[model samples]
Target: MKQLLILCCLCFLSAATLAQATWIWYPGDYEIWLSNRMQNRRTDRGTFFPVFWKMDSHYPLMDFHKDVTLSEPEQVRIYAEGTYNVKLDGQPFEGTPTVITIPAGKHRINVKVFSQATVPAIYIQGNKIISDSSWLVTYEDKEWIDETGKTSDITATKWLHAGSWNFNDPAILPSAFTLPVKPMAAVKTENGLIDFGKETFGYVKLNGIKGKGKITLYYGESKEEAMSDKGAVNVDWLTFDKAVSQDSTLPASKAFRYVRMVTAGDIHIDNVSMLYEYADVNEPGSFRCSDDELNQIYDVAKYTFHLNTREFFIDGIKRDRWVWSGDAYQSYLMNYYLFFDKGTVLRTIYALRGKDPVTSHINTIMDYTFYWFLGVYDYYMYTGDRTFIKEIYPRMQPLMDYCLGRRDKDGLMEGQVGDWIFIDWADGLSKKGPLSFEQLLFCRSLETMSLCADIAGNQPDAEKYRLLAADLKAKLFRIYWNDQKQALVHSTVNDDVTRYANMFAIFFDYFNAQQKEAVKHTVLLNDSIQHITTPYMRFYELEALCAMHEQSYVLKEIKNYWGGMLRLGATTFWEEYDPHESGPAHYAMYGREFGKSLCHAWGASPIYLLGKYYLGVKPTAPGYATYVVEPALGGLQWMEGTVPTPAGNISLHVSTKEMKITTAGGNGILRFGSSTRPTCTTGTIQQTKDNWYELSLSPGSTYVINYQSVK
Candidate 1:
């Protein structure tokens, strides 16, 4: 009888342990709060530089609740980040009770918190009752009292499932969240100046310091940038008076490899070290090839991407570490093939969206707004997280509505006052009146909305969005498609064609075969049209080529462009690479000596290109339930890599004469072309075309194929 009782107790303990609690908040509230903290950290040479646009904050008051039925009476422990009140079954707990006993029955637990500085978050724990995303939270409770002190209706109040990540410990508060950091010594030091030897970001620590005066630390991504006290983007000035030696860590995290310290009075430092602050995300996807230079480029791209991926996907580690929607859009794509960190992607999306009364476009840029929609679309494509889509659907509507309301009389997007039409950083780029590129992105965004609406179960809205997308797509072709130019013009202002619209159209599959070919020749191949210098636009331009089976050409371009940056001693990729420029001029941008970011998120496009285009692994269905792997050597002798999906890693090894493919999970199709008929040892090959063949791939199976090289 005792053994039987112990067994029952063990079973109950296991069940209770399975129900773990995590810190929770109103969805996106913490993200907005954290982004404000991160974005405001930017400083330009000791001067605080914030975003030009208005910054939004979390709701000052929030109400969180959960409906639960307990089998036995239990005491629930509560922790909150702000001033709070607790209630059980519509009855208020005496006075913010830390532990409250609930009778054995059905009850609704509520925690209302108010905070102005940080997001109102809570963590609750009990044997059967725990706080998690399952709990619902809202900014407004809308519960009122009548004249007689009776509770009024709150039927109109909207609630959403709480947002949470890995924060499960009771002692750890969500508001006190920070990235992990590690201490590292400087590689070399000259007098007061210290160099870490590579571009890095984090808090600077001055060890064994005894000072009685002011010390100015100039931070720079490049050595030249660090040395130039006047030109450095971020600077930290410290005034200290200490009789005994002590260590002082900088208050704010800054990005720099070289730190030039200029001290006044009696300031002494024994040594210099830094705490490298970085996001805790694992790299599940990777790429390597036969070419050593290409391998080097890939490694550098990954590092550049990692450096930019922190609290959110910022544009760069240094100078303007603000989350730009357009730059983040590229980061999302690269993320799918590198870290596959969906949490970061969702966090970034939420941060960018903010709490919208629908004022201005995201990042105050027109194209950026569309890219935000596209980012959501890709997120769903890669992760098939319908709950996320449903949760964010309401937010999407307002943004889309904002875009729709801003359309010109011709029913196209035009740059209005305060709208930065940042298509690229190129000089003389037209932002005037009804841009075709904007219209194209608008159409894509609408299509994304349509797809998401269907997933979100808004049938009528889905159909409406579909019609809007179709109508806009038709208009895009009708207005911008230049038959003579054989490409969509940059803008219809004077019917001048550029590569942006035509390139995007090709990859988006908006064009028919003939039009795609024409655009490829007339716009993409034609150098007379304004060349896309920024790696940002080049990402799409090259993607268009890869989509059109121009991998061979695109490979050369990637090497020439990305490899050119490598030759210039770029430890990480640059924001923009202009091969024509020379010496320190290469480092200069925006009319400043060191304005260009040496490690921009968009510069890591090769990670996406090689993974998706060359390795040829992409989801044909959402969440990679079904995917396609069509490996292209792209002029390399051999290549092997893993592309991460929500399901698992889809690995590939390809050479001139043979190919091998394996997937951890998912239904996949292995497609390739060869001069001769291919033979697969593990699977049967079906000839899809004259020289093309396709093989069905099953999870946990390796398929090896031997074929004559077509190229």
Candidate 2:
């Protein structure tokens, strides 16, 4: 079966190649089939986006050299010979044992050390190096050694969850902890002294207490020695109820966010002094991308997960505490591919897959696999590499089948209690759980799976999924369509919930005439051109709408959505928009919250794909057979960019007269099959009547298009 699947996929790739010079979609092609196939293709994975800043000299730079040491101060001045660029406290300190200042707030610096000499060398771990969200140990700097020993020391210390974002791909179950709660009391003994006492077993609640109070402990016989302030390390005092507490017997420590006290007290006894225990350094190692060049691209998100159920641990190790929330996990999953490797991403996914379905930590296999493929497809898209798909697609088959093949008698995919079966955002209000939108997403996932299956040559499986997808779409309409509202309801049980469900239905092309028109009316508007807008929705929600071709309102919402991400306290994209006042823990979800910073990859997709690609800025579609130049320019000042398409550099230039595109240098031709459809003229560039054009454009020059009505 696996071999057949592999063969089918190979055949599909072979067929696609035979149909066109390359396997990717291009601009000049039949609109319907090309768009459908491209949309159905898996999303790009851990590949870098086309748009990137060229790292300048000012950016922290690192060069590699062989042979070095930092065993001692004297050793630092002598024998410490390698490339410099390790800046400590803003001063360039070469070699090892150099004194450098560490700013108060966490500062991320890039380190580049290489060894080319035949004899190997070692780079000792520096002090207070914060990578991957955790501190790394200081290793002894030794003589020339094996070069493979160089490893990242930074690690993550916390986890977040706001919404759809999951910083770590795949995912794992969340962590849990338990602490002992004690009770307390106050009693005036014998003469005039007040001897306060605490009980380890009894229940005591500190409710409705106004002013501050404290209970001092007395140790030995007489009040002098017994009340001596100086005592043993084991001596400690327990303040009122709090999320954290100090133990004299243990090291000093602080909680990531919150700590709760089950019981409160006015009691203190003997052996007691303030003592804090530090949490052990549980995880080790640092992030994969620590170079200054990529630091701008890397953000707190690289250290934290926005959504999903994975704990932030160094080197894939477990933490002593639960550091993230569910909301952050989802955001991470959708965005983490920007800076990580496939193996790292796969490891993270495997952890999440192993999680219990009951806990929000893992959700279900369907949601995980669906998003996983989205990332995998992205990997293929940006890098134009098929090895990952060829190697990993087989493993993904069973998960895809589980989501599609397993069904209820009612023809519905089974979702857990809090699990989102097939609904988009906002439908969570439906107590019944995942509705039409959710099912639509499932169908979308199946569609992608079927594409993979067909490519893999699993004809029986491909037919099975295709049929299932068709049936699900039909069932989605029957169940959620509202004739009275003239649109699809957010859920079958609610009419007031009528929202952008129809937009997705239209975007997914899952509707009929009346339905499509109803959706077009309520969901989109032609502002300037066919630009889609979502007034009350979040940016990601809008991206799905735009990606799904809710094209009518895309332009107006594009800038606002991207701008909104910046407005939040995000240096890059966030799991969700953080309201004006939000604490570290008070984000959108309980497991992976949104306050996580440093997300750029997926969040930047709409700008490139929607604003740049769809809005006719500078984007191309690699056709299944030929090129189709259909430009839709949203309201961007002007966009000129080149994406690494399978057909070489597909350069698209859009202005206000004629849209011009050139492939490679001018060596490539824009071929449009005879079957190309001709639509009316609109936008800055006049829509051409010809199906194809082969032209040469000067480098750094642009093509223009004049604005026209959409009627």
Candidate 3:
């Protein structure tokens, strides 16, 4: 009762906090927002304001400038003529005829431009101050806005200016571009400020108006030596030629915050602006789910295809965009399966929406070990939503057929062998690579696909796939199994060395019992070369052992691996072990250990598998119709966890003292846990260190199960 009371209060407080937050504005309400938008700068704390050039969906806005020069920093001040309350860092900034200051810094500003009682042209005079004479002429440019309200790109012409700073003036220039909607300017009108519906957005522009000509920027090896915060870097000694007419091209370094133009003489001018239809997206938010944050990540991952087209969402709220960086595909797939097995209804629907049939499926598989099949299998294990299964089977069938249909002449699936013989884990072993592993993975996915077809009542397809998979397995054994090694060779063509490949095949039951035991012995006790050791050294060792039911070894590896991660200052997993040089995201090393995250999804998979199998909490075999209650504790102090299964919520509280388990509050029967070893069939069970147990029970019924301890 006390816990429930506290939970209620916490929920209320969270709701209130989100409701009270508001957007803030900065530097008064002037045209400074235009400058900020182009540079992708944010101010007023972390609140994002719309770009001046790109207005909101409804309003049209635009701007162009004639004078361009880079000295300290100068601005064409915008005068607000109307009285309004705008935001500054989630706080309100109000009043009329406000002055906007533009400094040479990064800032994303937001300001409202009002209309006049009559038609008034709003213009701000360009300001320039040229203090240097030794600088040579560099390049010039022209700017424009795409007012069409759709996808548009603009370019600038590059040329050299020969005149001196004194000759460059704002009076004479090129054609004046029309604003997308209304423009903001200071003038005497009937109303103090013109009101133009809601606010619009766009960019500002600066043509190559020359002053002291173009200045070639120099830099040191490091940012510290380049220039100081006080602008104190001496470049007076470096000399270059005067400006000559050239194409306006942006270099990689200048792409971020600055644009440079040169002149043959000493003239320089600067302007950058454009109007765009944009919304405020930098609102501070994250995917926060109490029970399944990992699964939430997966739910978001399926929408990777949307990254190029649209922003993501959880529920209906939009989310930040995530790109596919190639290094993180493992994390993405694992998350997909985690959510799929947990039965997140919204996530399931979201998965349906992400289906692109060929491109997405192929991308998910070819790029990441054909790993998508496990998620599909898990989806069936969680929901038993036959309708959904049927819908997806056809879409995925073609691809599955392709993999199964393309076996070698010997009937073994033909493909490049992955780094080792193992399909799921990717690491190099002596003389082994990725092809054989990929073939194994292809074989595994086919078998699972056949089972799915059977469950969907597509028996003919199931039989066909099943027969094909069986034939492939037989040929694989005939071709790859080495009689001398008494284990599966790394490759039939190479026959070079043996490693995790044979063990993985045995773990997945791709071999018979005698063969499986022989391979297990070879990996765990027989082979010195493949023995599991350090967490980093044997990253996938525990999972492989678990697949082989080498409980003692699995337990040992788990303790060492998990403890090492915790000791490494990991709050979450990381892409690598060493905290030091993991790339731009340096802080990620402090999170979890998701090494290479593309293959293993690392820390996430370990946690999920431990929670599901070791904790004896799992989904029912027949989808959500029931629950599986068998958990493997692997000699932990104690285990307490809750998994959201299709039947309802399955809670697990295992007493290590007596090796007993207590399950409560779930629908269907606990099918897997017995007095022996727990192998989940339906409801729940207490898994022993080295035994097999199964359970059967109904929802809301209390079941107490005890197991004999091995130690």
Most accurate candidate by TM-score: 1
Most accurate candidate by lDDT: 1
Ten residues in sequence with the least summed lDDT for candidate 3:
311-320
Better of 1 and 3 by TM-score: 1
Regions of model 1 farther than 4 Å from truth: 1-18, 141-155
TM-score of 3: 0.47
The number of clashing residue pairs in model 3 is: 109
lDDT of 3: 0.38
TM-score, model 1 to reference: 0.95
What count of clashes does model 1 give?
0
**Tens digit of per-residue lDDT, candidate 3, span 215-268:** 433221112222322221211111233254222222111101111222245544
Candidate 2: worst-modelled 10 consecutive residues by lDDT: 20-29
Sorted on lDDT, best first, the list reads 1, 3, 2
Deviation (Å) of 144 in candidate 2? 46
Better of 1 and 2 by lDDT: 1
Off by over 4 Å in 2: 1-366, 373-387, 404-406, 417-428, 431-434, 495-500, 512-514, 523-540, 544-553, 564-570, 578-630, 658-660, 664-711
- Please give the lDDT score at residue 628 for candidate 3: 58
Error of 2 at 66 (Å): 34
lDDT of each: 0.89, 0.35, 0.38
When summed lDDT is taken over every stretch of 10 residues in candidate 1, the lowest stretch is 143-152
